[model samples]
Target chain A: MADLILLFFLLVCAVTAVAQRELLNSAIILSIYSLIMAVVWVRLGAVDVAITEASVGAGISTVLFIAVLTRVKRREEITRFRVQVLPLIVVLAVGAALIYGTLDMPDFGSAAAVSNTHVVPRYLEKGVEETGTDNYVAAILASYRGYDTLGETTVIFTAGLCVVLLIRSEKKRRL
Target chain B: MMDFILAKYNFWIYVIIMMIGFYAVIAKSNLIKKIIGLNIFQTSVFLLFISIGKVEGGTVPIYQGVEAVYINPLPHVLILTAIVVGVSITAVAFALVVNIYREYGTIEENAILEMSKTDD
Candidate 1:
Protein backbone atom coordinates (compact mmCIF):
# COMPACT_ATOMS: atom_id res chain seq x y z
CA MET A 1 0.00 0.00 0.00
CA ALA A 2 2.80 2.39 0.95
CA ASP A 3 4.78 1.52 -2.15
CA LEU A 4 1.72 2.16 -4.26
CA ILE A 5 1.30 5.64 -2.83
CA LEU A 6 4.96 6.49 -3.19
CA LEU A 7 5.02 5.35 -6.80
CA PHE A 8 1.91 7.37 -7.49
CA PHE A 9 3.54 10.52 -6.12
CA LEU A 10 6.67 9.76 -8.05
CA LEU A 11 4.67 9.58 -11.25
CA VAL A 12 2.84 12.81 -10.50
CA CYS A 13 6.02 14.69 -9.63
CA ALA A 14 7.83 13.53 -12.75
CA VAL A 15 4.94 14.68 -14.92
CA THR A 16 4.51 17.97 -13.11
CA ALA A 17 8.19 18.79 -13.16
CA VAL A 18 8.41 18.23 -16.89
CA ALA A 19 5.23 20.19 -17.58
CA GLN A 20 6.32 23.35 -15.75
CA ARG A 21 7.21 26.41 -17.84
CA GLU A 22 9.34 28.02 -15.15
CA LEU A 23 12.79 26.49 -14.97
CA LEU A 24 13.14 27.16 -11.27
CA ASN A 25 9.81 25.55 -10.53
CA SER A 26 10.82 22.54 -12.54
CA ALA A 27 14.08 22.24 -10.64
CA ILE A 28 12.31 22.51 -7.32
CA ILE A 29 9.79 19.90 -8.34
CA LEU A 30 12.62 17.65 -9.46
CA SER A 31 14.11 17.99 -5.99
CA ILE A 32 10.83 16.88 -4.49
CA TYR A 33 10.80 13.98 -6.90
CA SER A 34 14.24 12.97 -5.70
CA LEU A 35 13.14 13.07 -2.07
CA ILE A 36 10.23 10.78 -2.83
CA MET A 37 12.65 8.52 -4.69
CA ALA A 38 14.81 8.34 -1.58
CA VAL A 39 11.91 7.13 0.53
CA VAL A 40 11.08 4.55 -2.11
CA TRP A 41 14.64 3.30 -1.95
CA VAL A 42 14.34 2.86 1.80
CA ARG A 43 11.18 0.88 1.36
CA LEU A 44 13.06 -1.31 -1.12
CA GLY A 45 15.68 -2.13 1.56
CA ALA A 46 18.47 0.03 0.20
CA VAL A 47 19.46 2.33 3.05
CA ASP A 48 22.78 3.33 1.53
CA VAL A 49 21.20 4.27 -1.79
CA ALA A 50 18.47 6.17 0.03
CA ILE A 51 20.99 8.34 1.82
CA THR A 52 23.00 9.00 -1.34
CA GLU A 53 19.89 9.87 -3.36
CA ALA A 54 18.59 12.20 -0.65
CA SER A 55 21.88 14.05 -0.46
CA VAL A 56 23.15 14.00 -4.04
CA GLY A 57 19.96 13.68 -6.07
CA ALA A 58 17.88 16.09 -3.99
CA GLY A 59 20.56 18.31 -2.50
CA ILE A 60 23.59 18.88 -4.72
CA SER A 61 21.80 18.46 -8.04
CA THR A 62 19.17 21.04 -7.11
CA VAL A 63 21.84 23.49 -5.97
CA LEU A 64 23.75 23.09 -9.23
CA PHE A 65 20.59 23.46 -11.28
CA ILE A 66 19.62 26.66 -9.47
CA ALA A 67 23.11 28.05 -9.81
CA VAL A 68 22.96 27.56 -13.55
CA LEU A 69 19.43 28.98 -13.65
CA THR A 70 20.68 32.15 -11.98
CA ARG A 71 23.19 32.69 -14.76
CA VAL A 72 20.58 31.96 -17.45
CA LYS A 73 16.93 32.75 -18.12
CA ARG A 74 14.37 31.99 -15.39
CA ARG A 75 11.45 31.09 -17.68
CA GLU A 76 11.47 29.22 -20.95
CA GLU A 77 10.60 31.36 -23.94
CA ILE A 78 7.56 30.66 -26.18
CA THR A 79 4.71 31.05 -23.68
CA ARG A 80 2.39 28.65 -25.45
CA PHE A 81 2.85 24.91 -25.03
CA ARG A 82 3.41 23.32 -28.42
CA VAL A 83 3.70 19.59 -28.81
CA GLN A 84 6.16 18.32 -31.38
CA VAL A 85 4.65 15.39 -33.20
CA LEU A 86 7.85 13.60 -34.22
CA PRO A 87 9.37 13.50 -30.74
CA LEU A 88 6.08 12.44 -29.23
CA ILE A 89 5.76 9.55 -31.63
CA VAL A 90 9.35 8.51 -31.04
CA VAL A 91 8.94 8.59 -27.26
CA LEU A 92 5.74 6.58 -27.40
CA ALA A 93 7.32 3.94 -29.58
CA VAL A 94 10.30 3.58 -27.27
CA GLY A 95 8.06 3.40 -24.21
CA ALA A 96 5.93 0.66 -25.73
CA ALA A 97 9.02 -1.38 -26.55
CA LEU A 98 10.27 -1.01 -22.98
CA ILE A 99 6.94 -2.14 -21.59
CA TYR A 100 7.08 -5.18 -23.83
CA GLY A 101 10.58 -5.94 -22.54
CA THR A 102 9.33 -5.91 -18.96
CA LEU A 103 6.75 -8.55 -19.64
CA ASP A 104 9.18 -11.37 -18.82
CA MET A 105 10.64 -9.80 -15.67
CA PRO A 106 10.05 -11.50 -12.35
CA ASP A 107 7.42 -10.17 -10.00
CA PHE A 108 8.40 -7.22 -7.87
CA GLY A 109 10.22 -8.11 -4.61
CA SER A 110 10.39 -11.80 -5.37
CA ALA A 111 13.25 -13.54 -3.58
CA ALA A 112 13.50 -16.20 -6.28
CA ALA A 113 14.22 -13.66 -8.98
CA VAL A 114 17.29 -14.08 -11.15
CA SER A 115 18.91 -10.94 -9.78
CA ASN A 116 18.68 -12.25 -6.23
CA THR A 117 19.82 -15.73 -7.21
CA HIS A 118 22.94 -14.79 -9.12
CA VAL A 119 26.34 -13.85 -7.68
CA VAL A 120 24.62 -11.76 -5.01
CA PRO A 121 24.49 -14.83 -2.79
CA ARG A 122 28.24 -14.99 -2.34
CA TYR A 123 28.37 -11.31 -1.56
CA LEU A 124 25.72 -11.75 1.09
CA GLU A 125 27.08 -14.95 2.58
CA LYS A 126 30.85 -14.33 2.81
CA GLY A 127 30.98 -10.59 2.45
CA VAL A 128 31.48 -9.77 6.12
CA GLU A 129 34.18 -12.32 6.86
CA GLU A 130 36.03 -11.51 3.67
CA THR A 131 35.94 -7.73 3.91
CA GLY A 132 35.63 -7.24 7.69
CA THR A 133 32.87 -4.68 7.24
CA ASP A 134 29.50 -4.84 8.92
CA ASN A 135 27.82 -3.42 5.86
CA TYR A 136 27.75 -5.55 2.75
CA VAL A 137 27.33 -2.57 0.53
CA ALA A 138 30.41 -0.92 1.94
CA ALA A 139 32.37 -4.11 1.62
CA ILE A 140 31.36 -4.63 -1.98
CA LEU A 141 31.90 -1.00 -2.93
CA ALA A 142 35.30 -0.73 -1.28
CA SER A 143 36.71 -4.19 -1.91
CA TYR A 144 34.92 -6.24 -4.53
CA ARG A 145 34.25 -3.21 -6.66
CA GLY A 146 37.03 -0.87 -5.65
CA TYR A 147 38.25 -0.41 -9.22
CA ASP A 148 34.83 0.75 -10.33
CA THR A 149 34.95 3.35 -7.58
CA LEU A 150 38.36 4.44 -8.81
CA GLY A 151 36.98 4.83 -12.32
CA GLU A 152 34.09 6.86 -10.98
CA THR A 153 36.49 9.16 -9.14
CA THR A 154 38.42 9.65 -12.36
CA VAL A 155 35.19 10.53 -14.16
CA ILE A 156 34.34 13.13 -11.51
CA PHE A 157 37.83 14.59 -11.71
CA THR A 158 37.50 14.89 -15.48
CA ALA A 159 34.16 16.64 -15.06
CA GLY A 160 35.64 19.13 -12.59
CA LEU A 161 38.48 19.76 -15.02
CA CYS A 162 36.02 20.36 -17.82
CA VAL A 163 34.03 22.85 -15.75
CA VAL A 164 37.21 24.71 -14.82
CA LEU A 165 38.24 24.88 -18.45
CA LEU A 166 34.84 26.10 -19.53
CA ILE A 167 34.84 28.93 -16.98
CA ARG A 168 38.37 29.92 -17.78
CA SER A 169 37.63 30.11 -21.48
CA GLU A 170 34.59 32.26 -20.82
CA LYS A 171 36.59 34.67 -18.66
CA LYS A 172 39.34 34.93 -21.25
CA ARG A 173 36.79 35.68 -23.94
CA ARG A 174 35.26 38.40 -21.75
CA LEU A 175 38.72 39.98 -21.26
CA MET B 1 -5.36 -9.06 -15.13
CA MET B 2 -5.22 -7.32 -11.77
CA ASP B 3 -2.56 -9.69 -10.48
CA PHE B 4 -0.45 -9.10 -13.57
CA ILE B 5 -0.72 -5.36 -13.15
CA LEU B 6 0.13 -5.54 -9.47
CA ALA B 7 3.10 -7.78 -10.12
CA LYS B 8 4.54 -5.60 -12.87
CA TYR B 9 3.37 -2.16 -11.90
CA ASN B 10 6.80 -0.96 -10.80
CA PHE B 11 8.29 -1.72 -14.19
CA TRP B 12 5.42 -0.01 -15.91
CA ILE B 13 5.76 3.07 -13.71
CA TYR B 14 9.47 3.31 -14.40
CA VAL B 15 8.90 2.98 -18.12
CA ILE B 16 6.37 5.77 -17.94
CA ILE B 17 8.77 8.00 -16.02
CA MET B 18 11.58 7.25 -18.43
CA MET B 19 9.37 8.13 -21.38
CA ILE B 20 8.37 11.43 -19.80
CA GLY B 21 12.01 12.35 -19.46
CA PHE B 22 12.76 11.18 -22.97
CA TYR B 23 10.02 13.32 -24.40
CA ALA B 24 11.30 16.36 -22.59
CA VAL B 25 14.84 15.76 -23.80
CA ILE B 26 13.92 15.42 -27.43
CA ALA B 27 10.86 17.66 -27.60
CA LYS B 28 11.83 20.62 -25.41
CA SER B 29 13.57 23.45 -27.18
CA ASN B 30 15.29 24.82 -24.08
CA LEU B 31 18.72 23.34 -23.32
CA ILE B 32 18.30 23.43 -19.57
CA LYS B 33 14.99 21.65 -19.86
CA LYS B 34 16.72 18.96 -21.87
CA ILE B 35 19.28 18.53 -19.11
CA ILE B 36 16.53 18.30 -16.53
CA GLY B 37 14.91 15.63 -18.63
CA LEU B 38 18.19 13.78 -18.83
CA ASN B 39 18.42 13.81 -15.05
CA ILE B 40 14.93 12.42 -14.71
CA PHE B 41 15.75 9.73 -17.26
CA GLN B 42 18.93 8.72 -15.45
CA THR B 43 17.26 8.58 -12.06
CA SER B 44 14.49 6.35 -13.36
CA VAL B 45 17.08 3.85 -14.62
CA PHE B 46 18.64 3.83 -11.17
CA LEU B 47 15.26 3.16 -9.63
CA LEU B 48 14.75 0.27 -12.01
CA PHE B 49 18.03 -1.34 -11.03
CA ILE B 50 17.37 -0.92 -7.31
CA SER B 51 13.91 -2.36 -7.68
CA ILE B 52 15.43 -5.43 -9.28
CA GLY B 53 17.57 -5.87 -6.18
CA LYS B 54 14.64 -5.90 -3.79
CA VAL B 55 13.70 -9.13 -1.95
CA GLU B 56 10.30 -10.19 -0.66
CA GLY B 57 11.20 -10.25 3.08
CA GLY B 58 14.63 -8.72 3.33
CA THR B 59 16.44 -6.16 5.39
CA VAL B 60 19.10 -3.68 4.28
CA PRO B 61 22.31 -5.41 3.37
CA ILE B 62 23.94 -5.12 6.75
CA TYR B 63 25.66 -7.95 8.53
CA GLN B 64 23.53 -8.85 11.50
CA GLY B 65 24.50 -11.75 13.75
CA VAL B 66 21.17 -13.47 13.29
CA GLU B 67 20.33 -15.25 10.06
CA ALA B 68 18.38 -12.80 7.97
CA VAL B 69 17.54 -12.18 4.34
CA TYR B 70 19.59 -9.30 3.02
CA ILE B 71 18.53 -7.58 -0.16
CA ASN B 72 21.07 -7.66 -2.95
CA PRO B 73 23.97 -5.41 -2.00
CA LEU B 74 25.63 -5.39 -5.41
CA PRO B 75 23.06 -3.15 -7.04
CA HIS B 76 23.15 -0.72 -4.14
CA VAL B 77 26.92 -0.51 -4.39
CA LEU B 78 26.78 0.01 -8.16
CA ILE B 79 24.06 2.65 -7.83
CA LEU B 80 25.97 4.46 -5.06
CA THR B 81 28.73 5.15 -7.56
CA ALA B 82 26.24 5.79 -10.33
CA ILE B 83 24.43 8.49 -8.33
CA VAL B 84 27.68 10.37 -7.95
CA VAL B 85 28.52 9.89 -11.60
CA GLY B 86 25.08 11.11 -12.59
CA VAL B 87 25.73 14.36 -10.74
CA SER B 88 29.06 14.71 -12.47
CA ILE B 89 27.38 14.26 -15.82
CA THR B 90 24.82 16.89 -14.84
CA ALA B 91 27.60 19.29 -13.90
CA VAL B 92 29.33 18.82 -17.22
CA ALA B 93 26.05 19.22 -19.08
CA PHE B 94 25.21 22.44 -17.22
CA ALA B 95 28.66 23.76 -17.93
CA LEU B 96 28.08 23.18 -21.62
CA VAL B 97 24.70 24.87 -21.34
CA VAL B 98 26.26 27.84 -19.58
CA ASN B 99 28.87 28.10 -22.31
CA ILE B 100 26.21 27.87 -24.97
CA TYR B 101 24.34 30.70 -23.30
CA ARG B 102 27.51 32.74 -23.10
CA GLU B 103 28.23 32.44 -26.81
CA TYR B 104 24.72 32.60 -28.28
CA GLY B 105 23.04 34.74 -25.56
CA THR B 106 20.21 32.18 -25.55
CA ILE B 107 19.72 28.61 -24.32
CA GLU B 108 16.88 27.51 -26.55
CA GLU B 109 18.04 24.83 -28.97
CA ASN B 110 16.09 26.10 -31.97
CA ALA B 111 17.31 29.68 -31.44
CA ILE B 112 20.91 28.57 -31.08
CA LEU B 113 20.71 26.45 -34.21
CA GLU B 114 19.24 29.34 -36.16
CA MET B 115 21.94 31.68 -34.91
CA SER B 116 24.67 29.22 -35.86
CA LYS B 117 23.20 28.67 -39.32
CA THR B 118 23.17 32.41 -40.03
CA ASP B 119 26.75 32.66 -38.84
CA ASP B 120 27.77 30.40 -41.73
Candidate 2:
Protein backbone atom coordinates (compact mmCIF):
# COMPACT_ATOMS: atom_id res chain seq x y z
CA MET A 1 0.00 0.00 0.00
CA ALA A 2 2.73 2.45 0.91
CA ASP A 3 4.80 1.39 -2.06
CA LEU A 4 1.84 2.19 -4.27
CA ILE A 5 1.70 5.73 -2.97
CA LEU A 6 5.42 6.21 -3.44
CA LEU A 7 5.24 4.98 -7.02
CA PHE A 8 2.38 7.36 -7.75
CA PHE A 9 4.32 10.24 -6.26
CA LEU A 10 7.36 9.33 -8.33
CA LEU A 11 5.28 9.39 -11.49
CA VAL A 12 3.94 12.80 -10.52
CA CYS A 13 7.41 14.17 -9.83
CA ALA A 14 8.74 12.75 -13.08
CA VAL A 15 5.93 14.40 -15.05
CA THR A 16 6.18 17.78 -13.31
CA ALA A 17 9.94 17.68 -13.68
CA VAL A 18 9.89 17.17 -17.43
CA ALA A 19 7.03 19.64 -17.91
CA GLN A 20 8.72 22.53 -16.08
CA ARG A 21 9.77 25.31 -18.42
CA GLU A 22 12.38 26.81 -16.16
CA LEU A 23 15.57 24.79 -16.21
CA LEU A 24 16.33 25.42 -12.54
CA ASN A 25 12.89 24.28 -11.47
CA SER A 26 13.22 21.19 -13.59
CA ALA A 27 16.56 20.37 -11.97
CA ILE A 28 15.18 20.93 -8.49
CA ILE A 29 12.21 18.68 -9.19
CA LEU A 30 14.56 16.00 -10.39
CA SER A 31 16.37 16.09 -7.07
CA ILE A 32 13.12 15.38 -5.27
CA TYR A 33 12.50 12.62 -7.76
CA SER A 34 15.77 10.99 -6.79
CA LEU A 35 15.12 11.32 -3.07
CA ILE A 36 11.75 9.62 -3.42
CA MET A 37 13.30 6.95 -5.53
CA ALA A 38 15.81 6.29 -2.79
CA VAL A 39 13.01 5.83 -0.27
CA VAL A 40 11.24 3.48 -2.65
CA TRP A 41 14.39 1.41 -3.01
CA VAL A 42 14.62 1.10 0.73
CA ARG A 43 11.03 0.05 0.85
CA LEU A 44 11.90 -2.64 -1.65
CA GLY A 45 14.59 -3.93 0.76
CA ALA A 46 17.51 -2.67 -1.29
CA VAL A 47 19.31 -0.73 1.40
CA ASP A 48 22.62 -0.47 -0.41
CA VAL A 49 21.00 0.75 -3.61
CA ALA A 50 18.95 3.22 -1.63
CA ILE A 51 22.06 4.67 -0.02
CA THR A 52 23.92 4.92 -3.33
CA GLU A 53 20.92 6.42 -5.08
CA ALA A 54 20.49 9.01 -2.35
CA SER A 55 24.12 10.02 -2.60
CA VAL A 56 24.67 9.83 -6.36
CA GLY A 57 21.27 10.50 -7.88
CA ALA A 58 20.31 13.21 -5.46
CA GLY A 59 23.72 14.45 -4.36
CA ILE A 60 26.21 14.45 -7.23
CA SER A 61 24.01 14.70 -10.31
CA THR A 62 21.86 17.53 -8.94
CA VAL A 63 24.91 19.60 -8.14
CA LEU A 64 26.40 18.97 -11.59
CA PHE A 65 23.13 19.97 -13.28
CA ILE A 66 22.77 23.12 -11.20
CA ALA A 67 26.42 24.13 -11.50
CA VAL A 68 26.28 23.87 -15.27
CA LEU A 69 23.11 25.94 -15.23
CA THR A 70 25.18 28.92 -14.01
CA ARG A 71 27.40 28.63 -17.10
CA VAL A 72 24.44 28.23 -19.47
CA LYS A 73 21.24 30.23 -19.88
CA ARG A 74 18.79 29.96 -16.98
CA ARG A 75 15.61 29.74 -19.04
CA GLU A 76 14.93 27.41 -21.94
CA GLU A 77 13.94 29.23 -25.11
CA ILE A 78 10.49 28.36 -26.41
CA THR A 79 11.01 28.23 -30.13
CA ARG A 80 7.90 28.50 -32.28
CA PHE A 81 6.55 26.86 -35.45
CA ARG A 82 8.75 23.78 -35.03
CA VAL A 83 7.05 20.51 -35.88
CA GLN A 84 7.86 18.21 -32.93
CA VAL A 85 5.50 15.48 -34.04
CA LEU A 86 8.29 13.12 -35.00
CA PRO A 87 9.72 12.94 -31.46
CA LEU A 88 6.27 12.51 -29.96
CA ILE A 89 5.51 9.66 -32.33
CA VAL A 90 8.83 8.06 -31.59
CA VAL A 91 8.38 8.31 -27.82
CA LEU A 92 4.89 6.85 -27.94
CA ALA A 93 6.03 3.91 -30.06
CA VAL A 94 8.90 3.15 -27.71
CA GLY A 95 6.69 3.34 -24.63
CA ALA A 96 4.19 0.99 -26.21
CA ALA A 97 6.89 -1.49 -27.07
CA LEU A 98 8.23 -1.45 -23.51
CA ILE A 99 4.76 -2.08 -22.08
CA TYR A 100 4.33 -4.99 -24.47
CA GLY A 101 7.64 -6.47 -23.33
CA THR A 102 6.67 -6.35 -19.66
CA LEU A 103 3.65 -8.57 -20.22
CA ASP A 104 5.64 -11.80 -20.25
CA MET A 105 7.68 -11.01 -17.13
CA PRO A 106 7.10 -13.13 -14.06
CA ASP A 107 4.87 -11.75 -11.35
CA PHE A 108 6.74 -9.65 -8.84
CA GLY A 109 8.30 -11.52 -5.89
CA SER A 110 7.62 -15.06 -7.09
CA ALA A 111 10.32 -17.28 -5.59
CA ALA A 112 9.99 -19.54 -8.60
CA ALA A 113 10.89 -16.69 -10.97
CA VAL A 114 13.73 -17.34 -13.41
CA SER A 115 15.84 -14.62 -11.89
CA ASN A 116 15.64 -16.38 -8.54
CA THR A 117 16.50 -19.85 -9.81
CA HIS A 118 19.43 -19.01 -12.05
CA VAL A 119 22.75 -18.86 -10.14
CA VAL A 120 21.30 -16.92 -7.24
CA PRO A 121 21.11 -19.87 -4.88
CA ARG A 122 24.75 -20.66 -5.44
CA TYR A 123 25.59 -17.11 -4.55
CA LEU A 124 23.47 -17.36 -1.43
CA GLU A 125 24.92 -20.78 -0.57
CA LYS A 126 28.60 -20.53 -1.49
CA GLY A 127 28.94 -16.75 -1.72
CA VAL A 128 30.43 -16.31 1.74
CA GLU A 129 32.27 -19.64 1.52
CA GLU A 130 34.08 -18.67 -1.66
CA THR A 131 34.63 -14.97 -1.00
CA GLY A 132 34.80 -14.93 2.84
CA THR A 133 32.67 -11.81 2.95
CA ASP A 134 29.83 -11.50 5.44
CA ASN A 135 27.54 -9.60 3.10
CA TYR A 136 26.38 -11.52 0.05
CA VAL A 137 26.15 -8.38 -2.07
CA ALA A 138 29.63 -7.33 -1.07
CA ALA A 139 30.97 -10.82 -1.74
CA ILE A 140 29.55 -10.87 -5.24
CA LEU A 141 30.55 -7.33 -6.08
CA ALA A 142 34.15 -7.25 -4.89
CA SER A 143 35.04 -10.88 -5.57
CA TYR A 144 32.73 -12.69 -8.00
CA ARG A 145 32.30 -9.58 -10.09
CA GLY A 146 35.45 -7.72 -9.14
CA TYR A 147 36.64 -7.46 -12.74
CA ASP A 148 33.51 -5.62 -13.80
CA THR A 149 33.88 -3.30 -10.83
CA LEU A 150 37.48 -2.62 -11.89
CA GLY A 151 36.31 -1.61 -15.35
CA GLU A 152 33.62 0.60 -13.83
CA THR A 153 36.15 2.34 -11.63
CA THR A 154 38.29 2.89 -14.69
CA VAL A 155 35.36 4.47 -16.47
CA ILE A 156 34.95 6.91 -13.62
CA PHE A 157 38.66 7.68 -13.75
CA THR A 158 38.50 8.34 -17.49
CA ALA A 159 35.53 10.65 -17.06
CA GLY A 160 37.31 12.66 -14.37
CA LEU A 161 40.37 13.05 -16.57
CA CYS A 162 38.20 14.10 -19.50
CA VAL A 163 36.51 16.78 -17.45
CA VAL A 164 39.86 18.11 -16.29
CA LEU A 165 41.13 18.20 -19.87
CA LEU A 166 38.06 20.08 -20.98
CA ILE A 167 38.60 22.71 -18.31
CA ARG A 168 42.29 22.98 -19.18
CA SER A 169 41.53 23.51 -22.85
CA GLU A 170 39.15 26.33 -21.97
CA LYS A 171 41.87 28.05 -19.93
CA LYS A 172 44.45 27.67 -22.74
CA ARG A 173 42.01 29.14 -25.24
CA ARG A 174 41.50 32.19 -22.99
CA LEU A 175 45.31 32.74 -22.83
CA MET B 1 -8.83 -8.21 -11.12
CA MET B 2 -7.44 -6.20 -8.22
CA ASP B 3 -4.90 -8.97 -7.60
CA PHE B 4 -3.34 -8.52 -11.02
CA ILE B 5 -3.21 -4.76 -10.72
CA LEU B 6 -1.69 -4.85 -7.23
CA ALA B 7 1.01 -7.27 -8.27
CA LYS B 8 2.33 -5.32 -11.26
CA TYR B 9 1.42 -1.77 -10.36
CA ASN B 10 5.00 -0.83 -9.56
CA PHE B 11 6.22 -1.81 -13.01
CA TRP B 12 3.43 0.13 -14.68
CA ILE B 13 4.15 3.29 -12.70
CA TYR B 14 7.87 3.10 -13.53
CA VAL B 15 7.01 2.66 -17.19
CA ILE B 16 5.12 5.93 -17.05
CA ILE B 17 8.06 7.62 -15.38
CA MET B 18 10.40 6.19 -18.01
CA MET B 19 8.21 7.54 -20.79
CA ILE B 20 8.18 11.00 -19.25
CA GLY B 21 11.96 11.04 -19.24
CA PHE B 22 11.99 9.57 -22.73
CA TYR B 23 9.77 12.39 -23.99
CA ALA B 24 11.91 15.03 -22.37
CA VAL B 25 15.04 13.54 -23.93
CA ILE B 26 13.43 13.40 -27.36
CA ALA B 27 11.45 16.64 -27.39
CA LYS B 28 13.22 19.13 -25.12
CA SER B 29 15.51 21.67 -26.75
CA ASN B 30 17.69 22.91 -23.94
CA LEU B 31 20.88 20.88 -23.54
CA ILE B 32 20.64 21.07 -19.75
CA LYS B 33 17.07 19.87 -19.89
CA LYS B 34 18.13 16.94 -22.01
CA ILE B 35 20.75 15.97 -19.43
CA ILE B 36 18.20 16.26 -16.66
CA GLY B 37 15.86 14.09 -18.67
CA LEU B 38 18.53 11.46 -19.00
CA ASN B 39 19.04 11.54 -15.22
CA ILE B 40 15.36 10.92 -14.68
CA PHE B 41 15.44 8.08 -17.16
CA GLN B 42 18.44 6.41 -15.54
CA THR B 43 16.98 6.51 -12.01
CA SER B 44 13.72 5.05 -13.24
CA VAL B 45 15.63 2.17 -14.75
CA PHE B 46 17.27 1.66 -11.37
CA LEU B 47 13.89 1.53 -9.68
CA LEU B 48 12.68 -1.02 -12.20
CA PHE B 49 15.61 -3.29 -11.56
CA ILE B 50 15.44 -3.05 -7.77
CA SER B 51 11.71 -3.63 -7.81
CA ILE B 52 12.27 -6.81 -9.76
CA GLY B 53 14.67 -7.94 -7.05
CA LYS B 54 12.14 -7.65 -4.26
CA VAL B 55 10.88 -10.75 -2.52
CA GLU B 56 7.63 -10.25 -0.59
CA GLY B 57 9.13 -11.05 2.79
CA GLY B 58 12.80 -10.63 2.09
CA THR B 59 15.23 -8.72 4.23
CA VAL B 60 18.40 -6.90 3.25
CA PRO B 61 21.25 -8.86 1.72
CA ILE B 62 23.52 -8.22 4.65
CA TYR B 63 24.28 -11.26 6.81
CA GLN B 64 21.46 -12.19 9.08
CA GLY B 65 20.71 -15.47 10.84
CA VAL B 66 20.85 -18.33 8.37
CA GLU B 67 17.60 -19.37 6.63
CA ALA B 68 16.43 -15.81 6.08
CA VAL B 69 15.30 -14.86 2.58
CA TYR B 70 17.25 -11.91 1.29
CA ILE B 71 16.20 -9.97 -1.76
CA ASN B 72 18.33 -10.50 -4.84
CA PRO B 73 21.51 -8.53 -4.22
CA LEU B 74 22.81 -8.92 -7.78
CA PRO B 75 20.71 -6.13 -9.20
CA HIS B 76 21.71 -3.85 -6.35
CA VAL B 77 25.40 -4.38 -7.04
CA LEU B 78 25.04 -3.89 -10.77
CA ILE B 79 22.95 -0.76 -10.31
CA LEU B 80 25.43 0.61 -7.78
CA THR B 81 28.14 0.42 -10.40
CA ALA B 82 25.70 1.90 -12.90
CA ILE B 83 24.78 4.77 -10.59
CA VAL B 84 28.43 5.67 -10.19
CA VAL B 85 28.90 5.46 -13.94
CA GLY B 86 25.85 7.62 -14.43
CA VAL B 87 27.21 10.28 -12.11
CA SER B 88 30.60 10.35 -13.79
CA ILE B 89 29.03 10.49 -17.23
CA THR B 90 26.80 13.33 -16.11
CA ALA B 91 29.85 15.24 -14.98
CA VAL B 92 31.57 14.69 -18.32
CA ALA B 93 28.39 15.65 -20.13
CA PHE B 94 28.13 18.87 -18.16
CA ALA B 95 31.74 19.68 -18.93
CA LEU B 96 31.01 19.12 -22.59
CA VAL B 97 27.90 21.28 -22.37
CA VAL B 98 29.94 24.10 -20.87
CA ASN B 99 32.40 23.77 -23.73
CA ILE B 100 29.57 23.83 -26.27
CA TYR B 101 28.19 27.04 -24.74
CA ARG B 102 31.61 28.65 -24.94
CA GLU B 103 32.02 27.72 -28.60
CA TYR B 104 28.50 28.35 -29.97
CA GLY B 105 27.25 31.06 -27.54
CA THR B 106 23.98 29.14 -27.18
CA ILE B 107 22.89 25.89 -25.53
CA GLU B 108 19.66 25.39 -27.42
CA GLU B 109 19.86 22.43 -29.81
CA ASN B 110 18.45 24.29 -32.77
CA ALA B 111 20.79 27.24 -32.33
CA ILE B 112 23.86 25.00 -32.15
CA LEU B 113 22.81 23.24 -35.34
CA GLU B 114 22.42 26.63 -37.06
CA MET B 115 25.85 27.73 -35.87
CA SER B 116 27.43 24.54 -37.18
CA LYS B 117 25.61 24.89 -40.52
CA THR B 118 26.97 28.40 -41.06
CA ASP B 119 30.47 27.29 -40.16
CA ASP B 120 30.30 24.41 -42.67
Best by TM-score: 1
Off by over 4 Å in 2: A81-83
Per-residue alpha-carbon lDDT of model 1 for A10-34, expressed as tens digits? 9899988988989999999999999
lDDT of 1 at B82: 92
Cα deviation of A127 in candidate 1 (Å)? 0.9
Best by DockQ: 1
lDDT of 2 by residue, A1-175 (tens): 7988888888888888877778889888898989999999889888888888888888888888888888888888888746479888998898888877777777888777788788887898888778888888789889889998999999999999999999899889979
Candidate 1 docking DockQ: 0.88
lDDT of 1 by residue, B11-120 (tens): 99899999999999999998888988999999899989998998878988898864898888888988999999999999999999888899999998888999989999
Measured on C-alpha atoms, candidate 1 has an lDDT of 0.92
Interface RMSDs of the predictions, in order, are 0.9, 1.1
Give me the candidate number with maximum lDDT: 1
